[model samples]
Target: MKRKVFLSTTFKSLLFLLFSFIYTLLPLQAQQLYQPAEQLGELFEQVQLQSVFPDSKTFPDATPLASPDEILQAYQQQKDQPGFDLRTFVMNNFEMPPQPAADFRSDTSLTVIQHIEQLWPVLTRQPGNDAGSLIPLPNAYVVPGGRFREIYYWDSFFTMLGLQASGETELIQNMVDNFTHLINTTGHIPNGNRTYYLSRSQPPFYALMLRVLAQQKGKEILTNYAPALKKEYDFWMEGANTLNAANPAHRRVVRLPDGSILNRYWDDKPEPRPESYLEDVHLAQESGRNPEELYRHIRAAAESGWDFSSRWFSDANSLGTIHTTDIIPVDLNALLFHTEMTLAQMAEMQGNKAEAKRYEQRAKERQKALLKYAWNEADDFFYDYDFVKGTTTNIPTLAAVFPLYFCMAKRKHASAVAQKIEADFLKPGGVVTTLNRTGQQWDSPNGWAPLQWMTIQALRNYKHTRLADTIARNWTRRNIEVYQATGKLVEKYNVEDLTLEAGGGEYPNQDGFGWTNGVLLKLLTLHPELLQTTEQEAVLQR
Candidate 1:
């Protein structure tokens, strides 16, 4: 009996050793299943409690879930009037610019310009205030200071506008070349030149970038970048065509019910998301809320940007907001439609009829799906339809205007939405981001440069020239007014008050802004004719 016991003990020890060796040899991805300790620990406790007392009858009551149809009905009823008090919204949300000067003055005089030119190398320094992070090689320089602002995705789009207007065709081409080079090297474009954004991309602007470059340069440029464009497209559509499906994770492309595929924003690990944490803390401090609740609020905001959005927030979970889990988005799909159209055009030009036909068909199908699922006829706007909840947020925001820009919205529907904008969101200053009373930067009383430009362009596309012109002019006037008063361009503005207090973002109202300044120059130069288009005739006809 003593010998048998000894043998069993020795076998157990050997097994343990084998397991330890196997664990050590595991891949990094398998070994690093690191979830947030707090969240995971809570989940573990719940599992243990259920296992320990199988007969225990403890369940939380179900909260009522709002359907997209219900939200749309409610929004249709309430969207006509000003959704929130304009004055209070502006005052509560606005943040004044920091006191003291950063000295970014432009010198036009020959002597000063010459001196400034000599110092351009130092002045246009890339974001290297910290020695810890690697500085990216400089691309095109933002003039006046020659400072290297890595105009990421949106900044690049807006900067291209200025480059086009200022007759800097070479610079515009260089910007496109940089993006193409990055795509070829990395398989995807980073949000900026920052190492932090290397993991996830911003908007899929590769096709748009190519289209713009092609327009500016010619077919030769498009031909050169076609392979790069195709590679980036493959990156966005990664994991989408997999037959052996697995649980979705960051960077995985998922398909929606409508059969279109797109990627949603995600991070591999969960921490208190820096962007939402800052915004939520600011909001909680302003509203006098408990810090814990603010954390939850921030988590909710972060989850909203995730692939499985409904799973991220309690309020959103019931509506099958889960449909967005690895699902396509209206904006994303619309952008893809543009991509398909561009690709088809390129293929046709290249004498590839087979490829052109395939892309053209794909674009049409996506357009159909986007309109079918995302549009709410009753509300006269587009809201993200949660396929799971059969619900939509009836929130009239700038996202609604994207379809128009893509020429995806029907002429009649686009016209109706434009009228709704005039009746509701548009102010003397420009267009508000959304009608939500939350006072978020993406909410009302805050007007962003990109959204304003988008709205103006969308209206012009629909031949609503007059209203488009008015919006463009009003936005430019407000921008010029603020600049003349403060000698600075801001990231956003208090549209309601024409005040310097710009509100609602992770950072405290970023200035020395790149995109805002770029868009302003573009609108003023390329589309001045849009400002002169009259809406008086359309109103009279109505």
Candidate 2:
């Protein structure tokens, strides 16, 4: 027994020295752990909670049975028991439900609006340490579907669009404040509330959320959110001060051939994502390329929120050929362009003319860069540029709608983009994410709520009223039909085939979809004339 104690003490000392060495040598931006804890006690503690306890019961039934305080106490007090099994201890002592009480509503008779209202109560949560979450929002916040119980970055923008139209302005403000808190605490918001998501963010939608508020409230609200939004803009422009022609790109900032700056999807960590653990690990093993390159591509795709999509892959059909870091996405830059414009307007509202002018200039530069690189003259559409290959990508996607959505495109450009979308992109259900048929959820055959909102509004803004109405009617019908059939609004729909359900992702399709509810409500409010008829809801054709 004494010999075992001596060995444990020596091992702990070695781990302490290793941990100190890593902290000193590699100070990552997010302070993410490079490797798991090495000390046996720490390692054992992690395995018990993160691995043993988590993977023990599977999700739905997997919400932690103890409060964070209680769990921590149990871990501290009895973690050193001989042949310790924390899983058994938790099971015996806790009263966790078998499954998350099958979402509160099952009545197909409820109107889509009624269904959304029901979800508001079902999805709202107070600050707590639920199984997979650690959100710190002061007021209740809505979450997306299964396994996504935390407030997500980009998803909230579209979700708030519906919230605003529903007369729930305070909830929207509360969510925005939660994001503000995250930005202030973490320097930038992580992908979600989890500690593991700190190394990256999804599309920069902080400014857009403020835009939604300003439209409902006056531009004066911008003054309150201006600093937080600027902090967000600065997060995207972190390495811009040092960028020169020779350097060209560093972190999120990318310099085009014309000496103008735009942003790209990027993640500081060159490693697998914690949420999609097994999927990433399997990808790493199968990828013949350098593991670092593969990890960066995976991380970059997460930043785009179109993980495993053909849009970022060198071979559109092959996930193994993904090269996300080398591409500057059209939608991503357009969103940032809006951010720049919003910051300028907010500064003007605050009577800061100089700051406003600076941001206005930045917006102009980004607009010019998009027209120069993303526009395809012959195709009359925007495509993501392959920065490494020095050419525009061949894929045609709904992302082209953004230039019109932001009013950044010329009338001629909007005309061409609208014509292309009408001819190829629009389908029986709605506009697909892309024309490519790659079996990723973000590719053909799958239509998501946020993209549907963006495309419909962009078309209407460009005066393609007929096309916009057609797309909106079809898309909303899908939402209503699926709700009528399954009594649930889901994450994606079958836009291409139109007969089967949407598929292709790391997990099965999910319901209680926050953005879907948001976009559907906003559309119904915008064009109340285009209501679905129960008398004879026409069958969607393939």
Candidate 3:
């Protein structure tokens, strides 16, 4: 029996609009066994769908049948055959689709820096006339390769940092333009520019992206991109406008007992995600939780960009306990704070006095609410606030760095956070993503490029330069070590155990990494004076 929570009709109608946008959730991965429906439109249902598509190695990401016309054709041709094997039929009709090939090989002769510079050009993709699920972007952008072919929301920001280092300002400009285009079209940037990711968004990093551009282009970027930034801010602040003391929370906005508002990760989606179709279905069956609730929570985690991590689980070790929508991530609120402040800055720059004041007040309110709810003085570390549970969670992740990263933390708080990171977060290779190694890609051992950048930046923000340099060095060394060995950079690294490749979550480790190259480039550029030139030369010589 599932417990029901009644919601107001107005809120229900709002979610209905959000849901209508997410229609394409088809099973695309190979090896990932997904039982589909009998037929969705012209497509085969899960039953026949499983038999039709092969494994991940063979079929990847909303593939084998790219269109409704193709699906209709496949069923029409195979319906009469008594022994219709969907896989064989697909092969017969469509050309044997092969994954994109790389031109560069594992060349130990090249320095890791040189190898990365080589891969940057390869990772940078222009979609151009490329059709299908590799959704065409208006601008050229870097992709974290392997399975990913589309531009992601937050990934591009960190990736842009490296592009800046590579003197690729044009690429960064294109990335911002692409995001601006997305905001103009969709009201906010989706997690990635995919039809399936249409229902949700990743971490609200648009403001940060603008900041990166502003670093190069000056204050003009704020006014120039103000409309897109305003659209994004409005998207996150949608329900908050209508919210009042009588009804404080709606959608992403949550009004606490004291009438203070903060945002929570949310997705209007309530189904098995097409990309992770089988996994979502299997988890729903096994978890025994309300399937719709679980789906929403899972989707919310994706919005949080710490997808499938222990931080979202009610029980630290179990995927079944995932309740992502229940907690308010420190990072999400911090990003929103940045967004609000950025909006205010832009408004003031444009001489919009009334709008500037409104945004500034909003930022102040959020900062106060965040400190009240998210800060844990007892632990001397920031923890995600469990809005549903009514306390700070025990789980401590790199999200703690956000306050310092955004300059929200007080000197005392910043001092404590820097110490905490130095003591627990840092590893031999880099900072482990989280203390928990729950076999999720976002969990321990998997040190992602974005988090590494945030952590290093935060350390430097509080004048912990030596510690920041250490982290930057370790993370850069790990990235270089991996590149030297595989002749490639990956989406994430196993910072905890450098000997093993990073593993966990839905897919295999990805290479031609967008953020990896970007962060390395930016870090190297930022601390060129601190370079271990002899050590790097020794590694390359071998």
Candidate with top lDDT is 3
C-alpha lDDT (0 to 100) for residue 81 of candidate 2: 81
| lDDT (Cα, tens digit) per residue for candidate 2, span 1-542 | 01111223235334533443444353333443222111123423444335543432232233344454555567677869898776676565444432332646667767788778777767666654433334354456778866566778999998898788777766776687678767766678788776567778998889888778667666666777676788888999999878888898888888877778888888887765655544565677887778778888888898888876898889787788888888999999999999999988888888889999999999998999999999998888899999889899878888888889999999999999889888998888888888777778888889899888889889889899999988998888878877877888888999877569999877778888889989998888787765555214644431
TM-score of each: 0.66, 0.84, 0.88
Arrange candidates by lDDT, highest first: which order? 3, 2, 1
| Candidate 1 local lDDT, 252-316, one digit each (tens) | 45455445544444433333332223333344566564555444434433323221123222243
Q: How high a TM-score does candidate 1 get? A: 0.66
Each model's backbone clash number = 13, 0, 12
lDDT of 1 at 214: 61
Off by over 4 Å in 3: 1-70, 73-80, 92-98, 244-248, 529-542
lDDT of each residue in 1-542, candidate 3, tens digit only: 12234444335324532432232132223213222221233343442237354332233244434444566666777667899766565555444333543565757677656766777777777656444344456668877777776788998888888777766666777788777766756667899876667778889988888888778666665677777788888888788767776776677888777778899988887976766766787899999989999999999998888887899988888898998888988999999999999999999999999999999999999999998899998988888999877999879899999999999989999999888888988898889888897899998878988999999988888899988988888888888777766778888899988899999997888877788888887887777743465355555777
TM-score of 3: 0.88
